[model samples]
Target: MILPEQFDQNELFVLTSLLIFYSLLFWLPNRFPLSLIILMMISSATVARLTDHLLSGSKMNLYSIMDLDKYELFDFFTYLLYAPFGYFLVYGYDKFKLQGISVLLYILVWALGATAFGEISLLFGVFKYKEWEASYSFTYYFIMISLMLLVYRFFKRSYKLHKVEIYNR
Candidate 1:
């Protein structure tokens, strides 16, 4: 069977599915500050998308399950799928306040979840790796999770410090 072009049925389904799945986050109460979550979501999504573009599109010229024929509109939408996932990563960590071994396990669980999602995407034609292995995605998720946790910690610390300074004044 021939695959549909960019903006085809499969792409639309994936995009719509992402939106619906992301919307589920609204039903849950957010433990972290809303402002912080939004900030992380925007920054993480933008940075992640750019990183993917640079590595997959430009540097490696890697193949994709989505149409990568010149970074079309649908391909851009697929990147958006990560925004809510990013939010949840920080949200879950902050909500639990995981530390020590707990933190390690938490991150590992999320990384594994991400890897599973990647596999699901591959099955659904959301991604077809070219010169890339699923194991590489697990590694990527681990690194991204680590960086995100560091960023969240730094942001939270800075915000607390700023609050203290303001109160002292």
Candidate 2:
């Protein structure tokens, strides 16, 4: 059984925010195809969550677990908040169709967005940094966002390269 003390304001805020965002996403017409948007959300969330755990929870031990106490249910749920942001990232990238210096600028913008959110999270008691720094997060965001873009590109390319007849489905 879980204790009530485990769930706090930060976790609640994250959950409420995610719920509202998801509700909007479901009730509204999205910029990307429904399936593509869903795929990006899932892919980005999975990778971000996994990497976060490995970096902060295990390898670096940058911050204390969860609510600076233990790794509880609320902590895990908070990570889900990233899924919508991930969708937005992909959506922005796809909409721009950027190239040359524009692509570089776009990636930098997204990384800075991530950093801004990180700062907000810190202010909200979401994270407690130890050895980790903002520069580390910027680098991580740049690499992770770049990888996500590559994955999206590969997904698009594969579909184009292997077009199937309508009857094949």
Best by lDDT: 1
Model 1 — which ten-residue stretch has the worst lDDT? 160-169
lDDT for position 60 in model 1: 85
**Inter-residue clash pairs, candidate 1:** 65-128
The regions of model 2 sitting more than 4 angstroms off are 1-7, 31-35, 164-169
Residue 115 alpha-carbon offset, candidate 2, angstroms: 0.7
What local lDDT score does residue 59 receive in model 2, on the 0 to 100 scale? Answer: 60
Give per-residue CA lDDT, model 1, range 6-115, as digits (tens): 35556866877677868877876755666776778887778768776766775685656475446566666667777788888877787677899998999899999999
Per-residue lDDT of candidate 2, residues 57-101 (tens digit): 766777653465556676666667778777777666766677789
- Each model's TM-score, in the order given? 0.84, 0.82
Clashing pairs in 2: none
lDDT of each: 0.74, 0.72
